[model samples]
Target: MHFDLADLRLFVHIAESPSLTQGARRAHLSAAAASARIKALESQLDSRLLYRDNRGVELTPSGQRLLQHARLILRQVERLKDDFSEQGGDQAGHIRIFANTTAVTEFLPEVLAGFLAARPAVTVDLQERLNRDIVRAILDGSADLGIVAGPVRAEGLEILHFSTDHLVLAVPPGHALERLGRPPTLADTLGYFHVGLHEGSTLQSFLREQVERLGGTLNLRIQVASFEAACRMIEAGVGIGVLPETAARRHQRSMGLSILQLDEPWVVRERSVLVREREALPGCARTLVELLRQVGDGVVAP
Candidate 1:
Protein backbone atom coordinates (compact mmCIF):
# COMPACT_ATOMS: atom_id res chain seq x y z
CA MET A 1 0.00 0.00 0.00
CA HIS A 2 1.26 3.49 -0.80
CA PHE A 3 1.25 6.27 1.79
CA ASP A 4 0.66 9.91 0.92
CA LEU A 5 3.34 12.30 2.14
CA ALA A 6 0.76 15.06 2.36
CA ASP A 7 -1.32 13.04 4.85
CA LEU A 8 1.76 12.14 6.87
CA ARG A 9 2.91 15.77 7.03
CA LEU A 10 -0.57 16.89 8.01
CA PHE A 11 -0.69 14.22 10.70
CA VAL A 12 2.60 15.48 12.10
CA HIS A 13 1.20 18.98 12.19
CA ILE A 14 -1.93 17.80 14.00
CA ALA A 15 0.11 15.83 16.51
CA GLU A 16 2.16 18.86 17.43
CA SER A 17 -0.56 21.47 17.39
CA PRO A 18 -2.90 22.26 20.26
CA SER A 19 -6.06 21.64 18.26
CA LEU A 20 -7.20 20.25 14.92
CA THR A 21 -8.36 23.70 13.82
CA GLN A 22 -4.99 25.22 14.55
CA GLY A 23 -3.18 22.32 12.93
CA ALA A 24 -5.26 22.72 9.77
CA ARG A 25 -4.31 26.39 9.72
CA ARG A 26 -0.64 25.50 10.01
CA ALA A 27 -0.98 23.03 7.14
CA HIS A 28 -2.93 25.67 5.16
CA LEU A 29 -5.89 23.35 4.74
CA SER A 30 -9.54 24.01 5.38
CA ALA A 31 -10.99 22.09 8.33
CA ALA A 32 -13.09 19.88 6.07
CA ALA A 33 -10.07 19.14 3.87
CA ALA A 34 -7.95 18.24 6.88
CA SER A 35 -10.68 16.00 8.28
CA ALA A 36 -11.00 14.22 4.95
CA ARG A 37 -7.26 13.71 4.80
CA ILE A 38 -7.15 12.30 8.31
CA LYS A 39 -10.04 10.00 7.53
CA ALA A 40 -8.26 8.72 4.45
CA LEU A 41 -5.08 8.23 6.43
CA GLU A 42 -6.97 6.26 9.06
CA SER A 43 -8.64 4.15 6.39
CA GLN A 44 -5.29 3.42 4.73
CA LEU A 45 -3.75 2.33 8.02
CA ASP A 46 -6.95 0.52 9.13
CA SER A 47 -6.54 1.87 12.69
CA ARG A 48 -7.57 4.86 14.72
CA LEU A 49 -4.84 7.46 14.85
CA LEU A 50 -6.25 10.18 17.04
CA TYR A 51 -8.80 10.60 19.82
CA ARG A 52 -10.74 13.84 19.66
CA ASP A 53 -11.66 15.44 22.96
CA ASN A 54 -12.88 18.76 24.22
CA ARG A 55 -9.35 19.89 24.93
CA GLY A 56 -7.88 18.63 21.63
CA VAL A 57 -6.88 15.53 19.73
CA GLU A 58 -4.46 13.00 21.21
CA LEU A 59 -2.53 10.24 19.50
CA THR A 60 -3.88 6.74 19.70
CA PRO A 61 -1.43 3.87 20.12
CA SER A 62 -1.30 3.42 16.37
CA GLY A 63 -0.71 7.10 15.83
CA GLN A 64 2.02 7.18 18.49
CA ARG A 65 3.99 4.51 16.63
CA LEU A 66 3.24 6.02 13.23
CA LEU A 67 4.44 9.45 14.37
CA GLN A 68 7.96 8.13 14.83
CA HIS A 69 8.15 6.65 11.34
CA ALA A 70 6.43 9.68 9.86
CA ARG A 71 9.09 12.00 11.23
CA LEU A 72 11.89 9.81 9.87
CA ILE A 73 10.29 9.47 6.46
CA LEU A 74 9.69 13.21 6.19
CA ARG A 75 13.25 13.92 7.24
CA GLN A 76 14.60 11.60 4.58
CA VAL A 77 12.45 13.22 1.92
CA GLU A 78 13.83 16.64 2.94
CA ARG A 79 17.38 15.32 2.73
CA LEU A 80 16.74 13.99 -0.77
CA LYS A 81 15.52 17.40 -1.88
CA ASP A 82 18.54 19.10 -0.35
CA ASP A 83 20.85 16.60 -2.02
CA PHE A 84 19.41 17.48 -5.41
CA SER A 85 19.56 21.19 -4.61
CA GLU A 86 23.24 20.98 -3.71
CA GLN A 87 23.97 19.32 -7.11
CA GLY A 88 23.57 22.92 -8.50
CA GLY A 89 20.03 23.28 -9.74
CA ASP A 90 18.02 25.96 -7.88
CA GLN A 91 18.17 25.25 -4.13
CA ALA A 92 15.04 24.08 -2.26
CA GLY A 93 13.84 22.38 0.97
CA HIS A 94 13.32 23.72 4.50
CA ILE A 95 15.50 23.68 7.62
CA ARG A 96 13.94 23.51 11.07
CA ILE A 97 16.09 25.10 13.80
CA PHE A 98 15.43 25.13 17.52
CA ALA A 99 17.32 27.61 19.71
CA ASN A 100 17.24 29.09 23.18
CA THR A 101 15.83 32.53 23.95
CA THR A 102 19.17 34.34 24.17
CA ALA A 103 20.42 33.07 20.84
CA VAL A 104 17.03 33.68 19.27
CA THR A 105 16.99 37.32 20.37
CA GLU A 106 20.68 38.22 20.41
CA PHE A 107 22.71 36.14 17.97
CA LEU A 108 20.58 34.51 15.28
CA PRO A 109 18.98 37.65 13.83
CA GLU A 110 22.14 38.74 12.02
CA VAL A 111 23.32 35.19 11.36
CA LEU A 112 20.05 34.06 9.77
CA ALA A 113 19.64 37.32 7.85
CA GLY A 114 22.97 36.74 6.13
CA PHE A 115 22.26 33.08 5.42
CA LEU A 116 18.88 33.88 3.90
CA ALA A 117 20.37 36.62 1.76
CA ALA A 118 22.79 34.24 0.08
CA ARG A 119 20.34 31.35 -0.27
CA PRO A 120 17.02 32.93 -1.09
CA ALA A 121 15.42 29.67 -2.15
CA VAL A 122 15.85 27.94 1.21
CA THR A 123 13.29 28.30 4.01
CA VAL A 124 14.18 28.23 7.70
CA ASP A 125 11.60 27.23 10.29
CA LEU A 126 12.95 28.51 13.59
CA GLN A 127 11.53 27.90 17.07
CA GLU A 128 12.60 28.96 20.57
CA ARG A 129 12.83 26.25 23.22
CA LEU A 130 14.95 25.31 26.20
CA ASN A 131 18.10 23.25 25.87
CA ARG A 132 16.46 20.12 27.23
CA ASP A 133 13.57 20.36 24.78
CA ILE A 134 15.96 21.15 21.95
CA VAL A 135 17.86 17.99 22.82
CA ARG A 136 14.68 15.94 22.48
CA ALA A 137 13.73 17.62 19.18
CA ILE A 138 17.12 16.95 17.55
CA LEU A 139 17.22 13.35 18.74
CA ASP A 140 13.75 12.63 17.38
CA GLY A 141 14.50 14.08 13.90
CA SER A 142 11.88 16.76 14.45
CA ALA A 143 14.42 19.58 14.26
CA ASP A 144 17.42 19.84 11.91
CA LEU A 145 19.61 21.78 14.38
CA GLY A 146 19.52 23.42 17.78
CA ILE A 147 21.36 26.32 19.38
CA VAL A 148 21.17 26.44 23.15
CA ALA A 149 23.03 27.80 26.19
CA GLY A 150 24.36 26.01 29.29
CA PRO A 151 25.39 22.38 29.71
CA VAL A 152 23.37 19.74 27.86
CA ARG A 153 23.90 16.02 27.59
CA ALA A 154 23.64 15.29 23.85
CA GLU A 155 24.68 11.64 23.63
CA GLY A 156 23.86 10.86 19.99
CA LEU A 157 24.36 14.33 18.53
CA GLU A 158 27.29 16.15 17.00
CA ILE A 159 28.03 19.19 19.11
CA LEU A 160 29.84 22.48 18.44
CA HIS A 161 30.56 25.58 20.48
CA PHE A 162 28.26 28.48 19.64
CA SER A 163 28.82 31.58 21.81
CA THR A 164 28.90 32.87 25.36
CA ASP A 165 26.41 35.20 27.04
CA HIS A 166 25.91 36.82 30.42
CA LEU A 167 22.63 37.19 32.30
CA VAL A 168 21.86 40.44 34.09
CA LEU A 169 18.91 41.56 36.17
CA ALA A 170 16.64 44.24 34.67
CA VAL A 171 14.71 46.50 36.94
CA PRO A 172 12.65 49.62 36.43
CA PRO A 173 13.68 53.13 37.53
CA GLY A 174 12.85 54.11 41.15
CA HIS A 175 12.24 50.48 42.05
CA ALA A 176 13.47 49.32 45.44
CA LEU A 177 16.51 47.84 43.74
CA GLU A 178 17.77 51.36 43.13
CA ARG A 179 17.61 52.27 46.81
CA LEU A 180 19.82 49.33 47.69
CA GLY A 181 22.84 51.61 47.06
CA ARG A 182 24.89 48.70 45.66
CA PRO A 183 24.81 45.74 43.34
CA PRO A 184 22.26 43.16 44.51
CA THR A 185 22.58 39.43 44.32
CA LEU A 186 19.93 37.25 42.69
CA ALA A 187 18.79 36.07 46.07
CA ASP A 188 18.49 39.66 47.29
CA THR A 189 15.86 40.39 44.63
CA LEU A 190 13.94 37.13 44.81
CA GLY A 191 11.50 38.58 47.29
CA TYR A 192 9.70 40.76 44.74
CA PHE A 193 7.55 40.31 41.66
CA HIS A 194 9.52 39.42 38.57
CA VAL A 195 9.17 38.96 34.82
CA GLY A 196 10.66 35.82 33.32
CA LEU A 197 11.44 34.07 30.09
CA HIS A 198 9.41 31.16 28.78
CA GLU A 199 9.01 28.25 31.19
CA GLY A 200 11.43 26.02 29.28
CA SER A 201 14.14 28.58 28.48
CA THR A 202 17.62 27.66 29.74
CA LEU A 203 18.24 31.01 31.42
CA GLN A 204 14.84 30.98 33.08
CA SER A 205 15.20 27.37 34.19
CA PHE A 206 18.74 28.04 35.46
CA LEU A 207 17.55 31.09 37.37
CA ARG A 208 14.78 29.04 38.98
CA GLU A 209 17.27 26.35 39.98
CA GLN A 210 19.57 28.94 41.50
CA VAL A 211 16.76 30.48 43.51
CA GLU A 212 15.74 27.07 44.87
CA ARG A 213 19.30 26.50 46.04
CA LEU A 214 19.16 29.74 48.00
CA GLY A 215 16.03 28.56 49.89
CA GLY A 216 13.98 31.01 47.84
CA THR A 217 12.05 30.93 44.55
CA LEU A 218 11.04 33.17 41.73
CA ASN A 219 7.73 35.02 42.08
CA LEU A 220 7.17 35.67 38.41
CA ARG A 221 4.44 38.16 37.71
CA ILE A 222 4.52 37.28 34.04
CA GLN A 223 6.29 35.02 31.62
CA VAL A 224 7.28 36.30 28.17
CA ALA A 225 8.59 34.54 25.08
CA SER A 226 11.25 37.13 24.18
CA PHE A 227 13.74 39.41 25.92
CA GLU A 228 12.05 42.46 24.40
CA ALA A 229 8.75 41.47 26.04
CA ALA A 230 10.51 40.99 29.37
CA CYS A 231 12.09 44.44 28.99
CA ARG A 232 8.65 45.85 28.38
CA MET A 233 7.37 44.16 31.52
CA ILE A 234 10.19 45.74 33.51
CA GLU A 235 9.63 49.11 31.93
CA ALA A 236 6.02 49.09 33.05
CA GLY A 237 7.13 48.26 36.63
CA VAL A 238 5.20 45.05 36.37
CA GLY A 239 8.22 43.09 37.52
CA ILE A 240 12.00 42.71 37.52
CA GLY A 241 13.55 40.32 34.98
CA VAL A 242 16.84 38.64 34.16
CA LEU A 243 17.99 39.30 30.60
CA PRO A 244 21.01 38.89 28.39
CA GLU A 245 23.41 41.79 29.08
CA THR A 246 23.64 42.78 25.43
CA ALA A 247 19.86 42.80 25.02
CA ALA A 248 19.28 44.57 28.29
CA ARG A 249 21.75 47.33 27.50
CA ARG A 250 20.66 47.58 23.89
CA HIS A 251 17.23 48.74 25.02
CA GLN A 252 18.21 50.24 28.36
CA ARG A 253 18.02 53.81 27.13
CA SER A 254 15.07 53.45 24.81
CA MET A 255 12.93 51.28 27.07
CA GLY A 256 13.97 52.93 30.36
CA LEU A 257 15.09 49.65 31.87
CA SER A 258 17.95 49.46 34.39
CA ILE A 259 20.51 46.69 34.46
CA LEU A 260 21.37 45.44 37.94
CA GLN A 261 24.69 43.78 38.52
CA LEU A 262 24.77 40.18 39.70
CA ASP A 263 27.92 38.96 41.41
CA GLU A 264 27.17 35.30 40.86
CA PRO A 265 29.83 33.40 38.95
CA TRP A 266 27.45 31.07 37.11
CA VAL A 267 25.61 34.02 35.64
CA VAL A 268 27.89 33.72 32.61
CA ARG A 269 27.20 30.80 30.31
CA GLU A 270 28.31 29.30 27.00
CA ARG A 271 26.10 28.16 24.13
CA SER A 272 26.42 25.15 21.90
CA VAL A 273 24.85 23.91 18.66
CA LEU A 274 23.47 20.37 18.37
CA VAL A 275 22.68 18.33 15.27
CA ARG A 276 21.66 14.70 14.75
CA GLU A 277 25.06 14.03 13.16
CA ARG A 278 27.30 16.28 11.10
CA GLU A 279 27.69 13.80 8.25
CA ALA A 280 23.98 13.01 8.12
CA LEU A 281 22.84 16.64 7.91
CA PRO A 282 21.44 17.60 4.49
CA GLY A 283 23.19 20.01 2.13
CA CYS A 284 21.20 23.15 2.97
CA ALA A 285 21.45 22.43 6.69
CA ARG A 286 25.19 21.87 6.38
CA THR A 287 25.60 25.18 4.57
CA LEU A 288 23.59 27.06 7.18
CA VAL A 289 25.43 25.38 10.06
CA GLU A 290 28.80 26.25 8.57
CA LEU A 291 27.69 29.82 7.99
CA LEU A 292 26.61 30.00 11.63
CA ARG A 293 30.00 28.81 12.79
CA GLN A 294 32.04 30.85 10.32
CA VAL A 295 30.15 34.13 10.26
CA GLY A 296 31.53 35.68 13.43
CA ASP A 297 35.34 35.16 13.02
CA GLY A 298 36.06 31.45 12.62
CA VAL A 299 35.91 30.84 16.37
CA VAL A 300 32.75 28.83 17.06
CA ALA A 301 33.43 25.25 16.13
CA PRO A 302 34.29 21.94 17.69
Candidate 2:
Protein backbone atom coordinates (compact mmCIF):
# COMPACT_ATOMS: atom_id res chain seq x y z
CA MET A 1 0.00 0.00 0.00
CA HIS A 2 1.20 3.51 -0.82
CA PHE A 3 0.33 6.74 0.96
CA ASP A 4 0.46 10.04 -0.83
CA LEU A 5 2.44 12.93 0.54
CA ALA A 6 -0.58 15.15 0.12
CA ASP A 7 -2.55 12.91 2.44
CA LEU A 8 0.18 13.09 5.09
CA ARG A 9 0.34 16.85 4.76
CA LEU A 10 -3.43 17.10 5.13
CA PHE A 11 -3.33 14.86 8.18
CA VAL A 12 -0.71 17.01 9.81
CA HIS A 13 -2.75 20.10 9.08
CA ILE A 14 -5.83 18.47 10.54
CA ALA A 15 -3.93 17.56 13.67
CA GLU A 16 -2.74 21.11 14.02
CA SER A 17 -6.06 22.81 13.51
CA PRO A 18 -8.36 20.12 14.89
CA SER A 19 -11.23 21.90 13.16
CA LEU A 20 -11.95 20.69 9.67
CA THR A 21 -13.00 24.12 8.45
CA GLN A 22 -9.97 25.80 9.93
CA GLY A 23 -7.60 23.15 8.64
CA ALA A 24 -9.02 23.53 5.11
CA ARG A 25 -8.52 27.27 5.31
CA ARG A 26 -4.90 26.83 6.35
CA ALA A 27 -4.38 24.30 3.55
CA HIS A 28 -6.26 26.53 1.08
CA LEU A 29 -8.74 23.80 0.28
CA SER A 30 -12.50 23.64 0.49
CA ALA A 31 -14.09 21.82 3.41
CA ALA A 32 -15.61 19.18 1.17
CA ALA A 33 -12.32 18.54 -0.57
CA ALA A 34 -10.42 18.24 2.72
CA SER A 35 -13.00 15.87 4.16
CA ALA A 36 -12.95 13.75 1.02
CA ARG A 37 -9.18 13.47 1.18
CA ILE A 38 -9.27 12.42 4.81
CA LYS A 39 -11.96 9.89 4.04
CA ALA A 40 -9.97 8.48 1.16
CA LEU A 41 -6.82 8.18 3.23
CA GLU A 42 -8.67 6.42 6.04
CA SER A 43 -10.39 4.05 3.57
CA GLN A 44 -7.11 3.30 1.83
CA LEU A 45 -5.47 2.42 5.10
CA ASP A 46 -8.58 0.61 6.41
CA SER A 47 -8.25 2.54 9.67
CA ARG A 48 -10.09 5.42 11.26
CA LEU A 49 -7.65 8.29 11.66
CA LEU A 50 -9.76 11.05 13.14
CA TYR A 51 -12.84 11.55 15.29
CA ARG A 52 -14.99 14.58 14.63
CA ASP A 53 -16.77 15.97 17.63
CA ASN A 54 -19.07 18.92 18.16
CA ARG A 55 -16.11 21.17 18.87
CA GLY A 56 -13.47 19.86 16.44
CA VAL A 57 -11.53 16.84 15.34
CA GLU A 58 -9.12 14.71 17.33
CA LEU A 59 -6.62 12.15 16.13
CA THR A 60 -7.21 8.59 17.15
CA PRO A 61 -4.41 6.67 18.83
CA SER A 62 -3.37 5.23 15.48
CA GLY A 63 -3.42 8.63 13.87
CA GLN A 64 -1.26 10.07 16.63
CA ARG A 65 1.26 7.25 16.16
CA LEU A 66 1.25 7.63 12.38
CA LEU A 67 1.97 11.34 12.62
CA GLN A 68 5.45 10.74 14.02
CA HIS A 69 6.43 8.38 11.19
CA ALA A 70 4.77 10.61 8.61
CA ARG A 71 6.86 13.61 9.67
CA LEU A 72 10.05 11.55 9.67
CA ILE A 73 9.40 10.15 6.21
CA LEU A 74 8.55 13.50 4.72
CA ARG A 75 11.60 15.17 6.18
CA GLN A 76 13.90 12.40 4.99
CA VAL A 77 12.47 12.54 1.47
CA GLU A 78 12.95 16.30 1.31
CA ARG A 79 16.48 16.05 2.64
CA LEU A 80 17.35 13.34 0.13
CA LYS A 81 16.05 15.45 -2.72
CA ASP A 82 18.04 18.46 -1.52
CA ASP A 83 21.19 16.37 -1.12
CA PHE A 84 21.01 15.16 -4.72
CA SER A 85 20.21 18.66 -6.04
CA GLU A 86 23.14 20.56 -4.45
CA GLN A 87 25.96 20.36 -1.96
CA GLY A 88 24.95 23.32 0.21
CA GLY A 89 26.30 26.09 -2.05
CA ASP A 90 24.02 29.10 -1.56
CA GLN A 91 21.18 26.94 -0.42
CA ALA A 92 17.91 28.44 -1.54
CA GLY A 93 15.03 28.20 0.93
CA HIS A 94 13.17 29.96 3.71
CA ILE A 95 12.94 29.12 7.42
CA ARG A 96 10.22 30.33 9.76
CA ILE A 97 11.33 31.16 13.30
CA PHE A 98 9.44 32.50 16.30
CA ALA A 99 11.26 34.07 19.22
CA ASN A 100 10.69 36.19 22.30
CA THR A 101 11.87 39.80 22.24
CA THR A 102 15.02 39.19 24.25
CA ALA A 103 16.19 36.48 21.89
CA VAL A 104 15.00 38.45 18.88
CA THR A 105 17.18 41.38 19.92
CA GLU A 106 20.05 39.76 21.76
CA PHE A 107 20.79 36.24 20.48
CA LEU A 108 19.30 35.79 17.00
CA PRO A 109 21.13 38.51 15.11
CA GLU A 110 24.57 36.97 15.31
CA VAL A 111 23.38 33.47 14.44
CA LEU A 112 21.27 34.77 11.56
CA ALA A 113 24.11 36.91 10.23
CA GLY A 114 26.44 33.93 10.21
CA PHE A 115 23.83 31.76 8.49
CA LEU A 116 23.22 34.38 5.84
CA ALA A 117 26.91 34.89 5.19
CA ALA A 118 27.18 31.18 4.56
CA ARG A 119 23.91 30.84 2.64
CA PRO A 120 23.09 34.19 1.15
CA ALA A 121 20.44 32.73 -1.09
CA VAL A 122 18.31 31.66 1.83
CA THR A 123 15.88 33.92 3.64
CA VAL A 124 14.93 33.96 7.32
CA ASP A 125 11.44 34.88 8.39
CA LEU A 126 11.47 35.80 12.07
CA GLN A 127 8.52 36.74 14.24
CA GLU A 128 8.87 38.28 17.68
CA ARG A 129 6.17 37.00 19.99
CA LEU A 130 5.71 35.98 23.60
CA ASN A 131 7.05 32.63 24.75
CA ARG A 132 3.59 31.02 24.80
CA ASP A 133 2.92 31.99 21.19
CA ILE A 134 6.34 30.78 20.20
CA VAL A 135 5.55 27.39 21.73
CA ARG A 136 2.29 27.14 19.84
CA ALA A 137 3.95 28.16 16.55
CA ILE A 138 6.45 25.31 16.75
CA LEU A 139 3.80 22.74 17.67
CA ASP A 140 1.62 23.82 14.75
CA GLY A 141 4.48 23.60 12.28
CA SER A 142 3.90 27.24 11.29
CA ALA A 143 7.35 27.93 12.69
CA ASP A 144 10.23 25.64 11.82
CA LEU A 145 11.94 26.60 15.08
CA GLY A 146 11.18 28.51 18.25
CA ILE A 147 13.38 30.29 20.76
CA VAL A 148 11.67 30.89 24.07
CA ALA A 149 12.42 31.82 27.69
CA GLY A 150 10.65 28.80 29.16
CA PRO A 151 10.65 25.08 28.69
CA VAL A 152 8.11 23.80 26.16
CA ARG A 153 6.67 20.30 26.44
CA ALA A 154 4.30 19.27 23.69
CA GLU A 155 3.16 16.24 21.76
CA GLY A 156 5.63 16.45 18.88
CA LEU A 157 8.27 18.98 19.81
CA GLU A 158 11.84 18.51 21.02
CA ILE A 159 13.42 21.24 23.15
CA LEU A 160 17.13 21.83 23.57
CA HIS A 161 18.58 24.16 26.16
CA PHE A 162 20.00 27.23 24.39
CA SER A 163 20.75 29.64 27.21
CA THR A 164 19.86 30.84 30.67
CA ASP A 165 19.01 34.36 31.86
CA HIS A 166 18.55 35.88 35.26
CA LEU A 167 15.32 37.70 36.04
CA VAL A 168 16.39 40.85 37.85
CA LEU A 169 14.23 43.40 39.61
CA ALA A 170 14.36 46.81 37.98
CA VAL A 171 13.50 50.05 39.70
CA PRO A 172 13.86 53.62 38.60
CA PRO A 173 16.99 55.36 39.80
CA GLY A 174 16.64 56.42 43.45
CA HIS A 175 13.47 54.41 43.97
CA ALA A 176 13.07 53.15 47.53
CA LEU A 177 13.73 49.59 46.37
CA GLU A 178 17.04 50.62 44.82
CA ARG A 179 18.20 52.15 48.10
CA LEU A 180 17.45 49.02 50.09
CA GLY A 181 20.83 47.75 51.26
CA ARG A 182 19.61 44.18 51.65
CA PRO A 183 17.93 42.01 49.03
CA PRO A 184 14.16 42.14 49.44
CA THR A 185 12.17 39.03 50.34
CA LEU A 186 8.75 38.16 48.97
CA ALA A 187 7.00 40.29 51.56
CA ASP A 188 9.17 43.28 50.81
CA THR A 189 8.74 42.95 47.04
CA LEU A 190 4.96 42.80 47.32
CA GLY A 191 4.86 46.08 49.23
CA TYR A 192 6.21 47.94 46.20
CA PHE A 193 3.96 48.60 43.22
CA HIS A 194 4.74 46.09 40.46
CA VAL A 195 4.81 46.41 36.69
CA GLY A 196 5.06 43.22 34.70
CA LEU A 197 4.11 41.43 31.53
CA HIS A 198 0.45 40.68 31.06
CA GLU A 199 -1.18 37.39 31.93
CA GLY A 200 -0.83 34.25 29.74
CA SER A 201 2.84 35.08 29.13
CA THR A 202 5.85 33.08 30.28
CA LEU A 203 7.28 35.73 32.58
CA GLN A 204 3.91 36.35 34.14
CA SER A 205 3.25 32.69 34.64
CA PHE A 206 6.63 32.12 36.23
CA LEU A 207 6.38 35.18 38.43
CA ARG A 208 2.87 34.35 39.57
CA GLU A 209 3.95 30.93 40.68
CA GLN A 210 6.98 32.26 42.45
CA VAL A 211 4.90 34.82 44.27
CA GLU A 212 2.38 32.22 45.28
CA ARG A 213 5.09 29.91 46.56
CA LEU A 214 6.63 32.74 48.49
CA GLY A 215 3.27 33.30 50.20
CA GLY A 216 3.26 36.95 49.25
CA THR A 217 0.99 39.10 47.14
CA LEU A 218 2.10 41.47 44.39
CA ASN A 219 0.53 44.88 44.07
CA LEU A 220 0.51 44.12 40.31
CA ARG A 221 -0.14 47.75 39.48
CA ILE A 222 0.54 47.64 35.75
CA GLN A 223 0.43 44.89 33.17
CA VAL A 224 2.42 45.58 30.03
CA ALA A 225 2.99 43.18 27.19
CA SER A 226 6.65 43.75 26.35
CA PHE A 227 9.83 43.81 28.38
CA GLU A 228 10.78 47.15 26.90
CA ALA A 229 7.46 48.51 27.98
CA ALA A 230 8.00 47.19 31.49
CA CYS A 231 11.43 48.78 31.64
CA ARG A 232 10.10 52.11 30.39
CA MET A 233 7.35 51.98 32.97
CA ILE A 234 9.91 51.42 35.70
CA GLU A 235 12.00 54.28 34.38
CA ALA A 236 8.94 56.50 34.49
CA GLY A 237 8.56 55.45 38.12
CA VAL A 238 5.33 53.68 37.28
CA GLY A 239 6.42 50.72 39.33
CA ILE A 240 9.18 48.22 39.87
CA GLY A 241 9.43 45.53 37.15
CA VAL A 242 11.08 42.21 36.68
CA LEU A 243 12.97 41.67 33.44
CA PRO A 244 15.67 39.52 32.00
CA GLU A 245 19.12 40.57 33.14
CA THR A 246 20.42 40.93 29.60
CA ALA A 247 17.61 43.26 28.62
CA ALA A 248 17.74 45.22 31.88
CA ARG A 249 21.51 45.64 31.62
CA ARG A 250 21.29 46.81 28.03
CA HIS A 251 18.82 49.52 28.89
CA GLN A 252 19.71 50.36 32.50
CA ARG A 253 22.28 52.98 31.54
CA SER A 254 19.96 54.80 29.19
CA MET A 255 16.90 54.38 31.36
CA GLY A 256 18.69 55.31 34.56
CA LEU A 257 17.37 52.19 36.26
CA SER A 258 18.86 50.07 39.02
CA ILE A 259 18.95 46.26 38.94
CA LEU A 260 18.41 44.55 42.25
CA GLN A 261 18.84 40.85 42.89
CA LEU A 262 15.78 39.11 44.20
CA ASP A 263 16.28 37.40 47.52
CA GLU A 264 14.66 34.19 46.23
CA PRO A 265 16.42 31.41 44.37
CA TRP A 266 13.73 31.13 41.69
CA VAL A 267 14.63 34.31 39.85
CA VAL A 268 16.70 32.75 37.09
CA ARG A 269 15.10 31.81 33.76
CA GLU A 270 16.23 29.16 31.29
CA ARG A 271 15.70 29.52 27.58
CA SER A 272 15.51 26.81 24.98
CA VAL A 273 15.22 26.21 21.25
CA LEU A 274 12.38 23.96 20.13
CA VAL A 275 11.92 21.96 16.95
CA ARG A 276 8.85 19.99 15.92
CA GLU A 277 10.87 16.83 15.66
CA ARG A 278 14.56 16.20 15.22
CA GLU A 279 14.27 13.65 12.40
CA ALA A 280 11.76 15.82 10.50
CA LEU A 281 13.87 18.97 10.19
CA PRO A 282 14.37 20.17 6.63
CA GLY A 283 17.90 20.88 5.37
CA CYS A 284 17.55 24.57 6.03
CA ALA A 285 16.05 23.93 9.45
CA ARG A 286 18.88 21.54 10.31
CA THR A 287 21.47 24.13 9.36
CA LEU A 288 19.72 26.71 11.47
CA VAL A 289 19.65 24.36 14.43
CA GLU A 290 23.36 23.73 13.98
CA LEU A 291 23.97 27.44 14.05
CA LEU A 292 21.99 27.76 17.29
CA ARG A 293 23.78 24.84 18.89
CA GLN A 294 27.14 26.24 17.85
CA VAL A 295 26.22 29.64 19.15
CA GLY A 296 25.08 28.13 22.42
CA ASP A 297 28.49 26.51 22.66
CA GLY A 298 30.21 29.87 22.00
CA VAL A 299 31.91 28.56 18.86
CA VAL A 300 30.36 30.90 16.30
CA ALA A 301 32.58 33.37 14.46
CA PRO A 302 32.11 36.99 15.37
Off by over 4 Å in 1: 18-47, 86-90, 171-184, 198-202, 221-225, 229-240, 253-261, 296-302
Worst 10 residues of 2 by lDDT: 81-90
Which portions of model 2 miss their true places by more than 4 Å?
53-56, 87-90, 93-101, 104-106, 113-162, 274-280, 294-302
Top lDDT hit: 1
- lDDT (C-alpha) at residue 191 in model 1: 88
- TM-scores vs. true structure, each candidate: 0.79, 0.77
Query: Can you write out model 1's per-residue Cα lDDT over 238-291, one digit (the tens) per residue?
Result: 999878887999888689887888778877877778998876677778877777
Q: Candidate 2: how many backbone clashes? A: 0
Error of 1 at 279 (Å): 2.6
- Screening candidate 2 with a backbone cut-off below 3 angstroms (N, C-alpha, C), the clashing residue pairs are none
* Candidate 2 local Cα displacement, residue 274, angstroms: 5.0
